[model samples]
Target: MTSLADTPKAPGALRYTLLINAAPQSSQASKSALRFAESLLQMGHNIERLFFYGDGVLNASSLTVMPQDEINIPAAWHALIEANGLSSVVCVSSAIRRGIVDTAEAQRHELYATSCFTSSEIGGLGQLIEALSNSDRMLSFG
Candidate 1:
C-alpha cells in the first residue's frame, strides 16, 4: 500500500506551512495533516510552520480532556513540534473567540489558565502572511 511517506518531491523541494482549520476530531483533518507533515520531514523537507486557524485552535489546548482510551492529539502535536522545533502558531482572534487564551491574556482577563499550551503561541494574521512569504508551499487541511 502507498504511504504518505512515499509522497514525491520535485527538484528544489519546497518549504511548507500547514494551515489546519479543523479540530483534531472534527474529522481526520488535523491528524492526517500532522502525519503528512511527519512524512514530509522524513523525506527531508522543512515545515516552516503549523498554523492552527478556525476550529483547529483546539489542538493546542492544554486543558483538553479526552477519554483515557482516546488518543491525546494535543500531546502528540506538542511532542512533534517540540521535537522538531517547529513553529506552531494559533490565530489569536479565533482563539480568543473560542476561549483559548494565553498566559498573558489569561492574566489580563483575570481568568484561569486557558486550554492552549506553551508549545503554541497566540498570534495575529500577520504571522500567516509571514509564513506564506517565507514558505514555498502552503498546505491547507481545513
Candidate 2:
C-alpha cells in the first residue's frame, strides 16, 4: 500500500502581473499592491512586474510628501521593490502630468522636480502589454 506522503505533487508555478490604476494618496491601491506582492513571494509565486498606469505611477515616486505622522505608501513600495529586485514601470505621460518626472525632464520643462520618478523607468502602455503577455495571471488593483 502506498502512503499519501509517497504521492508526488505536480509542480505549480504562478506568474503575476499587477496593474495599479488609482492615485497613491487618496486610496489604498499602493498598500494593497505591496501586500499582494509580499503574499505572492511568501507563497513561492513569481511577480512578473508591477505596471503603474494613470495615477498608479505615483506609487514609484520618491518625492511624495505625506504628513510626517501619515503612512508613506510610495516609500513602502520602494522598499519592497529594492529588497525583492522587483520591476517597476511607470507610465511616462501619467507621471509627467502628476509631477513625477525625472530631473532631466524637469530641467528641460522646468517642471517640479522629485526623486521618486527617477528610480522607476518611464514607459508607455506597451510595457504593461508586455507584462500582461508574459504573466500567467494579471491582477488589477485600484
> Evaluated with TM-score, which candidate comes out highest?
1
List candidate 1 segments past 4 Å from native.
1-11
Per-residue lDDT over 22-108 for candidate 1, one digit per residue giving the tens place of the 0 to 100 score: 998789888999789888877868888899999999888887778999887888888788777789999998898889998888888
**RMSD in order of candidates:** 4.4, 7.6
Summarize candidate 2's per-residue lDDT along 1-142 as a digit string, tens digits: 1122122333685788999888778688778877887777766677788888888887877877789898888887776676667778888888888777776667878866555544467778898888888999999998
Off by over 4 Å in 2: 1-10, 107-112
Q: Give the 10-residue window scoring lowest on summed lDDT in candidate 1.
A: 1-10
| Native-referenced Cα lDDT, model 1 | 0.85
Clashes of each: 2, 2
TM-score of each predicted structure versus truth: 0.88, 0.83
